[model samples]
Target: MPLSFKPVSGLRLRWSRLFQRAVIAAAISVAGTAALQAGDDQPNSLPPVLQSSKLRLEARLAAEQGDFLHAAVALEQAALVVGDRETAQKAGAGRQQLEAQGGAMADFQSLMTLIMEQTAPPAQWIMRGDETGTMTPYMQGVFVGAPALAGAMAMTFDNSRLSTAAELARTANSNSDVLETSALRLVSLPRLEAEIARLQKSGQPIPADAAALAGLTEVQFLFVFPDSGDVVIGGPAGAWAQDEKGRTVSTASGRPTLQLDDLVTLSRTFADNGRGFFMCTIDPKPQQVQAVQQYASRLQLSARNARQETQKLEELLGLQNVTVAGVPADSRVASVIVDADYQMKLIGIGRRDGAAGMKSYFELAGRDERRGAAMDALRWWMTVGYDAIRVAPDRRAFEFTGRSVRCQSENQLVKVDGSREATGKADSANAEFARLFTEHLPQLAEKDVVFADLQNIFDLALASAMINTMDLDRQAGWQPAVFTTAGGFETQPVEVPRELMTAAASRVYRDGSIVVQVAGGIKVDLREVISNPQSFTTAPEVSSQARNASPVGQTGRWWWDAAVR
Candidate 1:
């Protein structure tokens, strides 16, 4: 009856190995079955090839037949199997085309490329500028192409500080011309130099600026996406300016001039290096109104009653309209002015009237009671805190300055409640409750407290009840309520809710000009810049220039691969 059992280590190991083999066999069988099913559904009419060109043709045929999913899958398999640069590049292009055709299976590489296509400054634009600064006092234009295409993109920036409106318009036109011409020159620089050499040989006059081409700084950035998922950057070797002595000098690193060949080497380095691709609109008041209206429509659909409540609140605030206007000046800071029209709801209320309203709102606990208290707060705020609102010259934006009125102050407390006796002694109980609920409970959750922990749940519930009670007391004009024990009530400092304190701490009340930015449906991808630095330094395709000459209607800014058709 007392027989002992001995452990068998070899038996356990053998069983584990057997289980693993069985699992692997099952997985292989499932995969094979799925592949066979797919083959049955869409029989490959052509032979699978190791060449990128053949794969691309196959993929294109599939796409034309509205089979982008199969095209993407086939191209990806070819790229992986062939493992060549050209095949990989074709795979990348195929993926983009599939995405453009509303395929959802695009990988990270293609997504990155799409982002770059949308945001990266054109190669020509990059060549013209040493560096690009964001949020500067200038207007920027971005050009993008169909995801299926490559080598045709650009962006431009125009200064907004001309003296007159007419002058600004004229300058913008001139700037566009300058940017286009500069792009053309960069792309055709080699041809131009060759022509210049021929002219010199034939004893023809060469422009004085012809020799300046050799000194043009070449900017190269290498983006390496290695298998280990690291991105390494290389040089931006060329961005040179002429010194006082008429010698070429780099604007940034003071490095030696880089040539086109050097840029190619850098690109090759990036291709060999990185694991991932590099990572890095709107109008004025009528546009603002349109956006608000659209949002309102959605809100109405979701919650009609809530929308009605919001309209009532807006009416109570007497907010007619708010406008934002910007003035372009010589300074780096763009000046924005906001003007607002207000018609105070309870403007003519006297002190007696305010007291009566507070009594009705708080003591009677009448519906819409907060409206009276809000009026009192607004009247006090306007009288003691706000300055007169003024309209700007354009009559679009408004400017006004005001400080927030603190209701916790003794004067403000008396102004709102009419008595210090109404302000109950604050105790640490409420503060403790807030800390336990807002801070400690969240910490417990982070610490992986089990759902079965009844004690923790009970503590949380107690804290929530305390917070609710405090909120109710505050609404009844008995804020900072003191809990009295058998002994007596202890006088404590007024305790503000942690949420209110957080909100107050985050508020930025400043005297600086306001800038209202409307996005222009563009973004920048630095990875693209790093990968193709030479392209930026060369002449853009003439077809790209033609496309940029005209404006195209834009759909929505955001797009999903599966929904892009």
Candidate 2:
């Protein structure tokens, strides 16, 4: 098994260099907006038709440089600067030209869709503090940043394409909601793919079992059959429906519904260039952080200028960037991890309530004893957690017993350039926040579906990862299913989020000096856990279960209830 988790310097920003470095090299040409929209403000200048022609030329130039994202971006800016003037037809033509010139059609189209969904942010980002003056954001919408180009930049994934033309497998979208519920349901990957292909060829609607993956919560059991060329994972499964946030969750247990999309995505991830892990980070821009820091230094911090001071802070701080590795940023799994990180930060900052034992940083720092602690930055994040993967003698069965997500914390010194460097130690108050976050997460997840959904996702990742890591497919004599092959099962593209604005606010110190805090991100690396010898344990119970967990003689059916103990 080739597993690796390379943790960077404590405060290093971890955007995928493939996309970020290339975009930086390209220089975006945002200054060219003036020429692209010549006809808009100056009627006497170039006509709208000529404007489209010029945009086409620029798009071609961008595409020629192998920068399809920028090429699409050029057209998107034109549409915004010069509204509705042959932009669609021009874009269609541009798409065709780019495709002919060696650009991936899937990549360009994803970029176009992403750009169309973004709009320019206002000049000033209006921000307010809590009654106690903490810059805790509203959970749902307050942090929605809309810096058109920057947001577009952060959301773009490295050339890792989504599986083609996802149909979302026609689950809850249809009327006839066929479903199944069981304590331990077994799913065979080969069987699931067969059903998907059959439904596709027949033009039939897929049922909940196939689409939502029979509502599987995790892979508690791994069963393989070499003779049948099947790979199956069994776990607690039940009927599921979409929640108010549009997430799929089990109707019975309210845990997240495991979808075919995630399975396909994770499978492809393991197969993609042998990438060992996936990660997403959302953090404040260093330049903006620096600017905000400079601005904060000059602030008078008097009661009279409080509101005005806050407006300045928000305006300069702007939105943070999102970056991902080992998967497309637009993939549903990436969004789940990023959103989970965000919600956890909210819980930490007193923006949202956590389960009983977890107190927010505000609550902890507001204590009379800690009034003047010198911590400038608080970093709270979640990472891979598993106690051990207990394996059977035959290596055909494995049992994992652990929480899927673990919380970690750090204190850093915000640098002069707006970057952060590890302070080597967290204040007792800061440490307590991270401790409570990890301890009460299970209880908190019971109240918040996003956290629960994240746990489920990583669990599936672990299971899928194990199959890939342990060479279980080879052991089972199974070939890669439709998952990584061309024109296989596709996942529907959901809107990738724009830059997340800095979740920064102030808590006035008793000493009258203000320390500005900014940024939190996700760092999920499973290499160390999977590669460590201690992570794997021997267990005979799994071998006994693997003997009976087979789906043999149950052809055509993809799932089944486990016989009672």
Candidate 3:
């Protein structure tokens, strides 16, 4: 008998068995402790008995002990750890059964409900274009929202043009022929949190900070064109026909008729790699954007503090009468301009001339003494050079010519300027700067600077100035207005909605097509448009082609079927 036992099949199998035994032993020990303390009136204060690492063992032990409530909780925890919705549902059913048997635990029941709810798959509402006689989809989009928020909404755009460097990169590397076609999906925070929780329980890697998850509810996807010719057909020809249920079908002889619902469904069912289908769900809840804004407000406040500190430092240095001029009248439009000019003025009290000289100079001026008395008094001192005089005036102005160029395949703004010189009075310097800037107005009006470039410059300048000049202990956080650059110029700052910012960030692809799914917060009220199909006008007939019949020369029909099935 001592020589009868053979080694295990593999080291992995042996290790797995050892691990299982250890987990079982630990679970039993914990269960024993729980049982001993079970009689304590306040079970709510008890430590967690089941752990994700030992879920299976805990479930088995609880079941053996006839502790159905604990068994149900263990089962749910196990399912969550495994990320198996089906298993979770099974645990939910088992918990319901336990509840019916005798005394039901309210906390256990609530947990079971939460597990079931969190694991349930979302519903998809799809929309398709009405154009007919074409295989290419004109417009196709879908909506998906979480169950948590009752009124969350999301939006999609067709024929959107890309402007950001990131978007352009996505388009260039995409395998799909239609680079411009893309989709944006928005999700709610609760939905995101649920996903993160599930991932955490499953021991999957995710960002540890909850704030990192903020503003991440948006996702993007590309749409790929479908293959030509039907699989059933030996040639390129295929027919559009009605199925028994009145659904539009694409098929050939001796093949299954693929029912077409919307482009997303078609792509998911027929296309490879989910090219035409958005791979993620997005939260469309308003709270998601509000979270971003709250963070943004904090950053804005920090920036304001930095500016105030800079002003105080300037006062302490006695750099009075400082005036800034030639800044773009519209800071928002400055980014798109081809050039910017600036002028600065400062009053320099005489250096090392002592406080008495400065006081007497100010006192004499305050008394309205004529220019001759001050000039004569100052001229009596040969040591004081005219240039070193307390009130010696200085003015500076410069023109920065900007050129848009592509660097590393990304649009960039390059400034060209080397010369610096002392100019005339503040009025002349400012006027000269303004005149030079106005010369580039035509170019600014015609071309738009890349939003990425503008955002980068603004963020860097603001953050660096705060950290370096103001000597801020913490780096100032500034939120760039990238959202405003994406087709949001029409609306004023106050009038623009936060949802528009989300939309701008998820703009249409470069090729001009877009798809989006939003879930949880505000609902997109497409119910009226979806329900009242009859209200839409019908497309006119094309060249005597019979209704429901595939046109001879045309590849496909773009129009929706009036009578499905």
Candidate 4:
């Protein structure tokens, strides 16, 4: 048993460093364009081929230095500047050269995919409002000021690797759903008369039938003894039961169950219980638990680092928080909150004009995109950065004491504590957003690469609705399965009650998100957490019909998106 909850370093941004690269790239691009176009007024003399080539070279340099977004934007701008020139002889030749040169775009795509897979904000982040108009994030994403930087930096880690490992473990243990880690117990009590005879012959106290023996079922046990320190038992179903006084009931006899404080009585009772069960426990030493936590933390940090790199790219491309508010009408950003933990308890966009306003969550954009590409770009930009936010903690510590039960049945005899210390850390969304933008925003904007289709639409709400319909909400920690493809990952189908069609449908409408329901839409979140492909027979069922109402026709659905994806 180990504490599953532990704090790991989060992704952090280096604002100055990112901004410096953007400025340099923009300067080169603008200067090159001006110099090349000096002689020609009707058509630029630099030629699309040379422009693309120069941009390509710049991309190579940026990527080599780990400025992926800048690199990607450079290549993208080259393409845009040369649009339709793909048919011209010079343009075709240049395109061929660019394609032939181990292009960086593919690498960019792979990197973005990895970031999306690895990055996830905590499940819930708390936003606090101060009368002074400054806000603080509570839980996981926090910022700490760097000495003399005049601004702050926000950091948080990722847990994708742990999730992958756990997933792999589950896949390998398909046949054994319940992990066997502790001792298993099996016992058969002899008849009262037989027990008495055995006690007499062995010069032992007679076991009493009136005595109570408790058993645990499907429980794994971690037990620590004064000398042994730690041991793990598989299927620990039975242990010496503790009485009301919180003392170990070591033995049963005609007199009364007696509490034992020493190993003599404990060992004698187990020996007396016969060879029916072995009492084992998982490691209980604090250090042992800490060791597992460190392992988890390492994995978390790797994920976090990867995520931060992705965020850097997003910020550089102007694909994160492309919208911000409250700046003086004429004020260019004087000081930016690099890691502004953009969190909202609620956000609603007016159906009439998409004038979105947020209540608990801060608005990254001062004004909503009015229409067309601006709207699309705004959505794409916000989506790309959403997974990087999380809750910040006021005071963090790292203490935990929890048990892991592994068995269920007779001879249970294991108990141990192994949870790790809980640590509280700060989360600052404002600081992160500011750092990414202050340096990289202008460069990305100049390149005109304003949108990134890097949105993660796993849409927890859709997944949960599907699960509710399946009636699996009663089960705790039953996560949805995911299946990914070229189009993206599809959520696992979930189990639901036959009657929750309308309830599920309404949830989808409220979110205004579209998903392809494999089965007409019966509200199944299992699509995301479907580990047992064989066990899942029904796909999610969706219909154009309103939630709860009967289908109007054969075309009517209970949980299908009316809007095309």
Candidate 5:
């Protein structure tokens, strides 16, 4: 039988996982397969030229395997090699062809097509993560999140799999145009506001750099300068460029850059009037679910009608409703979590491939037969992963540290009435998928920038929450300015969907066992995390971080690579 699976729910705005990971700033620098022959006069065996040839080979292989996006990406990477124009030309041409043929996202689309031909007449479909789904004859094939950054740096892909880094090596001379990666970075809100105000009064326009928040992708440190004139945030940063999907990312590493809009949106979410948390979920409606339950209980077992029966179930269940809380649906913060959740679903159901160690539910089916047959509907999700959030004694400095993502799974039993009861007994194979998902997340992020972007979003979210919770703004006497309402900073508007649908299909075994797979969800609550007393340990350095990493001397600059000190 041909492969059949559905996209995860809640991705309409997922163009926010920032669409898809494509080529980055430079060619795949360290790895490639063979030497190249550019021309007669030119050296055919230059390092870059050879690397480009090898990468192109890799791209071809990936395309053969139906991994079109990543394959085309190899071509994109190969096209960037500086020495040979021939390598660039062929690689570029290959990239355009691969993309035209569906690019990275084509894998899932292909699966859906096969499913329609093999499983049921109408077949399942891809959907907007935010849209509520219905089990109609046709499902909308929508999966792009629509959030355009105001003055978003023009992508240098310019978002083809439709979408989607850094740093500091410039030691020779002071060429301000060169991008550098920083292990630690600091930005002061009050100081930034002051600078913007100064710029405004001088009748100057806000440069793209200021609007994009200086290409920052993480926030690990929050420090207040003495006497209220400056507040600073610090974390790893590097050279950045926009990808095809309209997101700012590190040019060198391809991680999503944290935006000023996210920080501000999260601040409000953690504010006194806020929900103290953020969440995006795609769930089935009770009425439809109940209808499905009745069908399941009464259906006769047979391989002959398994596909036919499953279609009935999907029709009854219909599309799900996407719900977002604690953050604006149109905010970049909303986009990241939604996209991440959607992608995780794709990996689980075999719609998209993850890193080496990770396996989809389809791949792990027989490995743990107990959980596979014992549980009917399984759910998986991504949440915050934090070792600790320590504050300095005086509460002037804070450290928000954590891994990019955490995965958890459970078996859910749908009651006769359509309500779901958490079984919490994950099959061994299911458990392993979650474990591997979390374990290899960072590696996965390298290949797909969305994973990294999610990490950056969570870091900023937690940092923003900490700032609000700790009243760091009051300590620094910082008021919102440039990235504020009065400043008229326009950020990417997160795509909002009223209804979300599931991408679902079934596997009919020769033995008469029918397995229907559904995607999982996302739940994030910073209030509970922040309120944990143990989560907040006293760091002696809070008192000294301001004095030690003081931006006291530099008045005109907005941010800098801390390594320069």
Candidate 6:
């Protein structure tokens, strides 16, 4: 995913503001100079070199002030005045930077536009988080309750089958094989919200301070869908509904703490009206911004390269005769293949957008993606080790199955051969792994503390298992090896394999050793009773006060009959 913006690190925004003030002054000075020059009417032609130099300096000045839009305009003017290749390149780069900034500026404008257009009361305005640009509607409760669900969700991969999956995916033959995965979620949002509201409105005393706020708790809910593919963020549901009085009272403490429970309830009721799901942080830190910026830059560069290549392709292809094919409703391509005795056929379509050249685009895309995946695998090896172990157990194993190729050009197929010696229960291996984990823990924690231990075990176990199982001499149909867990609560799968069920558990539990499932916890609801309450049982004194009846056949039968009547 492309990132939103570059988070200026270390340099405070206050400093940027000061610099901007100075740049504004410079702009005013430029305006003044241009006015005076125009008044003289001396051919109104500044020297091309002088104009270009001034424009470049002005662009730099604007850039230093972080006014990328203005900087790009200056650079464009410079490009026009100088008429030099270098100047053109600089202008091109500046324009790209401005385009990137345009997205951020659009986001800012969108936010402002929303704020200005909202007709809600001033007190009802949702508080916006600086980091994620999410609005938090005021809750009718305490702020000090529960830890806000925050931080990046850790990504997990099954090292055992990753190599097989990666290889098959990269292979051209695997295109026909549809590898399907589904994302399943068990929701109790309705239940959770009602429970929270009930507790809040029970006339309970609110916590006095931050320390007392520790009593408010939140459980991390891990939703494990099938690990069929990468999990991307789905969009959020709409807002909760209000009553006739426009009351959306969720808590009693009068302080808003819009937690997951509130989201669930809101999502359940009148959706499309509330503060939607957004990634937010209490304190927007520099490190987070840097991550976003790096991603954004990489995406933008990729886009420009793609554009240039397309342009080049168009220049090469010139024009071509095109054909149209129409098939009847019941046409069959299988018959054509069968009649031809099942011969393989490959086709390529070359299309371009500009004067450069046309090339087989899909091939290039595949090659680039393959290279990126290989590079990522290498980095993962140095940093995580587990990734390398997934692909190849040792030097021998790497050579066995014929590693997947990373094609650089149409003809060149480059294979990445990375191997790590995998040994289990070996004194040296154990010692080495321990040392590595000890070194990595602190840095790993900064990213995600919960899954660090599990990932470490994954690296070791996968490496060890691959070492033992991946032997070319051994016949095919080798059962995929997996790390065995000790014991725990087990559940029956509706139809899927038992191992998949366990895999789902592993995604939730931090300790890979434990077989635990993340299930919906508890939910409650409260409503005032309008009618009088009645008792089913009576006390001894009350029992005596209650009347006793005689049998129908005796002398008192007449009295019993009368009473009945």
**In model 1, which runs have C-alpha deviations exceeding 4 angstroms?**
1-195, 203-214, 219-254, 260-565
Query: Model 4 over residues 197-250: C-alpha lDDT tens digits?
Result: 445467775222112211212211111111111111112222344444332232
lDDT of 1 by residue, 1-565 (tens): 0111110000000001111100000000000001112222222354444243344444433332222333454455555555655645655565555434323232433423322232213111121123221111111111110111111222111311111211111111222121122221121222333444456467776432333333332211111111111111111223356545333344553422322222221121122121111100111122222333333223321122433433332222221121111111111001000000000011111101221122111122122211112111111101011122121122111111221110111000112111111111111321222222222322322222121111211111111121221122223232121121211222222211111000000000122211110000111112122122231222112112111111122121110010000
In model 2, the Cα lDDT at residue 3 comes to 12
> Where's the lowest-lDDT run of ten residues in candidate 6?
21-30
Model 6 residue 345 CA deviation (Å) reads 57
User: Which candidate should be chosen as best, given TM-score against the real structure?
Assistant: 2
User: After superposition, which runs of candidate 2 have C-alpha atoms over 4 Å from their true positions?
Assistant: 1-180, 272-274, 302-308, 366-376, 508-519, 538-547
Give lDDT tens digits, candidate 6, residues 463-523. 2222222221122222121111111211111111111010001111121111111100000
lDDT of 6: 0.20
Compared with the true structure, model 4 gives a TM-score of 0.16
lDDT computed for candidate 2: 0.51
Q: What is the clash count for each candidate, in the order shown?
A: 22, 1, 33, 114, 37, 13
lDDT of each: 0.21, 0.51, 0.20, 0.19, 0.50, 0.20
lDDT (tens digit, per residue) of candidate 3 on 410-503: 0011111100111111222222322332233223322222222222222222211111112121111211121112211121111111111111
* Per-residue error (Å), model 2, residue 156: 42
* lDDT of candidate 5 over 1-565, digit per residue (tens): 1112233431110001112111000000001111121233332355875666655555543322223343434555666764445554544554455334322222244323322232212322112235321111111111111111101211112111101001111111232332566666666666666766777789897666665667676766666555635567766667788687767788867777777667667656554445444555555665665555455545563556655754665566567655555567777666666667767877876767899899876566662241233214555655566656555534455566566467765444444444333333566766777788988898899888768877877777666655554556666666665554435545557665646456644554444344555555543333334545655554443333333234434446667555342
TM-score of each: 0.15, 0.65, 0.15, 0.16, 0.63, 0.17
Q: lDDT of candidate 1?
A: 0.21
